[model samples]
Target: MTPHNELRLLPWSGPDGKPCFLSTDDTGGPLSRLADTTETAQLNVGQEILGHAMDVLADEEVETEELRLLARDLATALRDTLRVAVSRGHRLPALDPSTPIEANEGLRLSAAAFG
Candidate 1:
């Protein structure tokens, strides 16, 4: 069986809003390139939205409705950013399973803090 990390989590959704995946060794393939481009665009848009949000927050006269709209847009950008992060994270090289657990001290600490 292929390792879970080897199966890429695509940047887009599949049927019924389910997450899509790619399981190919070709990193330079058409689909991979497309996903890369899309992730880039999404991140750029997210950056723009964050800048705009900061500007909006600095305005004391900002209305409730405008703030509400900004909130929705921010939510959308956050969703896209998270998707990109998840996809990229899965694509990273897997850690050696034979390595000692002490090598993952930070990971263990994080898990303990969260769990």
Candidate 2:
């Protein structure tokens, strides 16, 4: 079985001394077997949301509070999208209803904010 909690967070300094958060995980099976699958797609979507948040932060004119709140909102959106996708996928008996389909760390990070 593949390892869990493979989520890797990468923070970089953005404009105006703001920190940008990014993460990538491949817990959804191997790429040789089509990493573009739905689970993987969901992960990619989450990354996209993060990237967009970074772009929003690059504007440099927005308030820090607003940026933090936007980052949190994006994180939640990513989590919700991933959760719904996973819930709709195959229902394994051995797997717990709460067992996250992607990396466990990714699940935890689903609520991460820029602050």
Candidate 3:
């Protein structure tokens, strides 16, 4: 079995909405491929959510119930986007304050805003 530290933690949730970790050393392995596929699907869904939100905002006759439903959907999409970002960010090694900003830019940006 691969050591816990060596396994890759996937960015998306499982069927039960729980985090999933993979033990494969090969990036092209089945689990890794599945993760890649799932991540793509998530991003696509997030984009679709944004488009739907735009439609809601553009509608002049949108009802209060429709607005509430749109807000809930946006919240869910935001949560999923944050989860994926954190998952991908966790894969990076810890960075020191002295490290160049360009190196590990995602971690630096997110840590500053979200930490």
Q: State each model's CA lDDT, in order.
A: 0.79, 0.49, 0.73
TM-score of 3: 0.67
**What TM-score does prediction 2 earn?**
0.31
Q: Which stretches of candidate 1 lie over 4 Å from their true place?
A: 1-5, 97-115
Candidate 2 residue runs with Cα over 4 Å from true position: 1-55, 91-115
Candidate 2 C-alpha RMSD relative to the actual structure: 14.7
Score every model by TM-score: 0.77, 0.31, 0.67
**For candidate 1, what is the TM-score?**
0.77
Q: In angstroms, how far off is 72's CA in candidate 1?
A: 0.9
Report the C-alpha lDDT of model 3 over 1-115, residue by residue, as the tens digit.
3333655668666899887787755767887778767666777888998999998899999999999988998887788777767766665556888878886576534452322
* Residue pairs with clashing backbones, model 2: none
Better of 1 and 3 by lDDT: 1
Cα error, residue 18 of model 1, in Å, equals 1.4
Candidate 1 residue pairs in backbone clash: none
lDDT for model 2 comes to 0.49
Candidate topping TM-score: 1
Q: Model 3 residue 105 lDDT?
A: 74
Clashes of 1: 0
| 49-85 per-residue lDDT for model 2 (tens digits) | 7787888878989888888888787877666465544
